[model samples]
Target: MTIAPAASTSALSFDPADPVALTQALVRCPSVTPEEGGALALLATALAAEGYEVHRPVFSEPDTPNVENLYARIGSEGPVLIIAGHTDVVPVGDAAAWTREPFAGTIENGILYGRGACDMKGGLAAMAAAAIRYRRANPDAPGSIAFLVTGDEEGPAVNGTVKLLEWAHRRGERFDHCILGEPTNPATMSDMIKIGRRGSLTGRLTVQGTQGHVGYPHLADNPIRGMVRLLAALDATPLDTGTAHFDPSNLEVTTLDVGNPATNVIPAQAKAVFNIRFNDVWTPETLAAEIERRLREAAGNTVRYEIGFQPTNAVAFLTEPGPFVAMVADAVAAETGKRPALSTTGGTSDARFIKSYCPVVEYGVVGKTMHQIDESVAVADVLALERITHRLLASYFAAQHNA
Candidate 1:
C-alpha cells in the first residue's frame, strides 16, 4: 500500500545502519498527544520498505480522544519478539524558551535535539534500524519481529497499548517476549535495564463541612483542618520497609484545594489529591481498603470525609532474571563495555501493560533531557543503542534456533 508523506516534514531516505537520519526525520513530525502528525505514517512507510505488513488502527472512546496505533510484523511464524514504543510526545511548553525549534530535529554538536528524541523517538528509530539490519543479514531468522507503536502513551493511555494488545490477541498474535523502548537510562546509555516498575494509585479525598462565619467556632465545621489531620494519618507510618526487589511504598499529596478566597468564611468542602507508588506487597483493592481503614480511624465521628480511587491499570510487576534478561544485558555490555544494573526503580510505562502477555523489560537511551525544553540525545548513543538492539536480536534468534 502507498503511504503519504509525513505532514510535518518531507520523507528522507531511510538507512538501516544509520538510525540518526531516521531519528531526525521522525522528530520533524509534531505528533503531540492524540495527533497523528504523520509520525506513524512515516514509520509504516519505512517498515513497508523493509517487508513488514503494517496495520494502522485508530481506537476511540466516549470522551477520550481517538488514538492511532500501529502494529507491523515482518515474518510469518516462530517466536515473536515485539519492540514497543510511542511516537506521540508531550506538549512542548513555552516554545520561545527552547534553544532550537522543538520540532526541527536539528543535530547540533553531535547531539540530536527535539521532542521524543530520548523519551523515545530515537529509541524507536534504533529499534527499526536494528530489525531491518538483522532481517537483511539473517533472512531466515528463527523468530518473527514486530513493532507496536502507539500515539496515546502520554495521554490518558485508555486507547493505547492496553487495547492494542487485546486487539492483537483476538487476532491470535502471541508474543514470546517484549522490549519497551522507554528512556530507562538515568545518566548514560549503559546505566540500567528496568526489570520491573512500581504500581501507581491516585486518590481524591474530599472532606465535608458546614460553611459559616470563621469567627463562629461553634457554628462552622472546617473541613480543611480535618483534611490535614487525615492526610497526616495516611503519611504517619511507612507503607513498608524496602522489599528485596522493590523500594518502600511512598504516598505523596500532590494537591490540596479548598478554593475559598474569603478569610471570613469557612469552606463547605476541602479536597486533597494524593498518589501512591506502591510495591508488590499490596494490591489495589487491599491498599484502598487499608487506606480507608486508616482514614476512618483518623476521622472518627467528628470528621466527615469521602475517599475515591482513580481507575488505573498500572500494577507492580517483575520480569525474573532469566536467559532473556541476561542475553539483553550481555548485548549492552558488549556494545558499551559497561555492565548494566538490573533495576526496578522508575515511573511506570507501557511495560506494565505488556507484562500480562509475556516477559517484558525496558532499556533505551539516556533520559535526562526527555520532556524538557531542549530535549535531545547524543547521536553516538543513538547508533550505540541500535547496535545493542541488533546484537540482542541476533543472540535471541540464535538461542531460540539452538534450543
Candidate 2:
C-alpha cells in the first residue's frame, strides 16, 4: 500500500520545524508523575490554538495522589478517532550520566536528547504536528479527532485514564478507536507494533517461625527453610504449556530477605517477593489462588505464612486483525517496506486500560535509547515517524468515511 505523495507546503502546511521544537518544549518541563509542571498548560495552549475544545480535569481517589489530565476534541461526528498519550515522565536518575542536561532537549549530531524524547514526548509531537498538517490541508475533513492525555500514566495510575474515561463517558463522549504513542519498536522504526500485551501480577510472601540460636537447630523452626520450600514449589510448576498468541508464562523471584545480621541467630521471619508476566491462560484472580495453593502444600502445615497480592488491572488483551491494526501494518510497510510483526511480547502498558474502552494498539519510534542515560531519537527516524503518522490519519479517516 503506497502512501500519499510527500507533503508539500500546501499539504504539509504546519511548520515541520515545530515538531522537534514541541518535543523539546515538553522535555524541558519536569512533569514527573502526579505533577503537572506546566506540561498540561503548554499542550492545552497548543491545541486551543488549533481550535480544539479542550478540558483539563484534576481527579483524585481516597488514597492515591491527585492527578491532572486533559481531553480535547476538534470535531464531533462519526468515527471519532482518539489520540492518547501521557505528558508525565519517569524520574531521570543520576543526571551526571547524561551527556547533556536531562531537560535541556539538546540537539547535537541530528539527535534530540531529553528524558521524554523517545518514551514519548517525540511521539506526542508527531501526532500534534500531523494533526495540524491534516487540518490545514483538509480544513473540512469528515469525521473528527480528539486527544485523551493523562499526567498519571507513570505513577500508581489511580486517577489517570481509568478515571478520565469514565468522566468522558458520563458526558456522552465516545471513541471508535485509539492509538497510543508509546515507543514500541525495538531496534528500528519499523521493527514491530504492539497488538497485545502480557499481563503482570506481583505477590509478597512472609513466612513465620520461632527465633532462636542457630546452635539449637532441633528446637527452632527456621522460617527460612519454609520460605525456601514454598518458593521452590511455586517455581517448579509451569504456569501453562504455552499459548499460540503468547509466549510461555514465566515467573521470576524478585526479592528474598531475612534481615537478620547476627551469624548465630535464626531469624523469626523470612520474606520473598515474586512477579509473574503471564499470558491469556491466567487472570489475576486465578493465578493468585494458584500461588496460595502452592504455598499451602509446600509448608505442609509446619509454618504459618501470609501471602499478599497487589493486583494491577494489567490484564492480557489482544486487538485482533482489523482496520486499526491493519492501518498501522500498512503504514509501516509503506514507509519502510518491512512487514512488521504484530507482537504481544512486551510488559504491560497503558494500552491495557485503553483496550477496555476501545480497540487500541501501540506504535512509535525505535526505543533503543528510551529510559537509558542520554535517551535520544534520530532526526531522520523522527521525521519518518511524522510522515507515517500523517499518512495513517489520512488513510484511517478515508477508510472510515468510505466504509
Candidate 3:
C-alpha cells in the first residue's frame, strides 16, 4: 500500500554535495534487478531522517519471488507531487571490460562511474536532492510530495510499477502529477523529452518438421525452409508509415536457429524470434493477427508451427501538450536554452504504467552511457539536472498554488 506522512514530517535540507555522494552511495549497492542491495534501506533511512514517512513493502506473485520497494512522503495533504524512478540496474554483462569496478561507484577526474550511475541512480539522487532543497526552501508548501520507487523495474517488470500503483491505489493515494527520472535526454541533454512511447511486442516462432536425411527431400518436410519463408513474409513489408507523434512501426527478426550440426541430416525443428515496436496505427491484437496470417500463408501446410508471443503491452501513449508538458519544456528551455522535442519514440519504460494514473513525463540526465560498461554521469550535468528538477517541482507546485 502507499505510504503516508509520518507523525511529524521534518523540514530537511541536504548539501548539494550530498546528491553526488548519494549517487555514488546508490551505485555502490548491487541492487541488480529485484535485489534490494540495501539501496532502498539507505533511501528510507535518509528520507526518515529528513522526517518523511517511509514504507518499504515486499511485493510478490505466484512464481516470482517477492521484491522490496520504498514509498516515502513528506506531507499528508493535497496537490500531491510524486517523483518516481527505479533503483535496480541490469547485470554487468562482462565485468572485465569495465574501466573501473562496476559497483565500486568510483569517481575520477570529476566523473562518477558505476553501473547505476546514469541508468537511474544518478537521476534518482538528483530528484531526492532537489526534493530536499525544495522542502528547505518552502517548508510549508502546499500539497504533499512523495516518492514511489520499485526494485523490479529493470527485470521481468511483472511485480514492479504495475503492482506498486495497485498497492498505492488500494490506500487511496492520488497523485496530481509524476516525474519519472528516466534517462530521457539523448545527446547533450537538449535532445528529447519522452512524452510517450511506442508499443513493443516480442514473439518466438517454432516451425516443426519431420527429421530426415538431406538427400531424402521428397520423404520429409524441412522446417528450416518453412522458417525462412515465414521470416521473409514477415520481413517483406514495413508495418506503417511514420505517425505524427510516433515513428513508423518496424518489426525485426532477432534470432533464427536450427539445432543441427550434421551435413546430411535435416533438423526436426527451426525457431525464430522477432519483435515489433508499433505505433498507434496498430494495436497488439491487430499486429499479432497480422503476424499469424503472414506465417500461415508462408507455411501453406508445408510445415506445422507453434507461435508464442510475449506481450509487453507498451501500447503507444502520449500526454498531450498540456501544463505538465509545457512546464517541463519551459524548464529545459530556461535551463539549457534549448526546447526539447516532445518525442514518443524509443523503448518502453515504467512511465507506461504511470500514465494510467496521472499525467507523466520523463526528464533526466543524458543517457549516452546508461547501459554501457563504464556508465557515468558528468558532475556538471548532475548539478544541472538537479537544478532542472528543482525548477520543475517549483514551477509545478507554484502553478497548483496559483490555480
RMSD of each: 2.6, 5.8, 2.8
Candidate 1, 68-159: lDDT as tens digits: 88899989887999999999999999999999999999998999999989888999999888998899898888889989989999999988
Sorted by lDDT (best first), the order is 1, 3, 2
Clash count in backbone of candidate 1: 0
Q: Rate the local accuracy (lDDT) of all candidates.
A: 0.90, 0.84, 0.84
Compute the lDDT of residue 375 as modeled in candidate 2: 86
- Residue ranges of candidate 3 with Cα displaced over 4 Å: 1-17
Name the candidate that leads on TM-score: 1
Cα deviation of 373, candidate 1, in Å: 0.3
TM-score versus the correct structure, for each prediction: 0.96, 0.94, 0.93
Model 3: lowest-lDDT 10 consecutive positions? 3-12
Tens digit of lDDT per residue, candidate 3, span 38-91? 788777767877667787777778788578887889987888888999999999
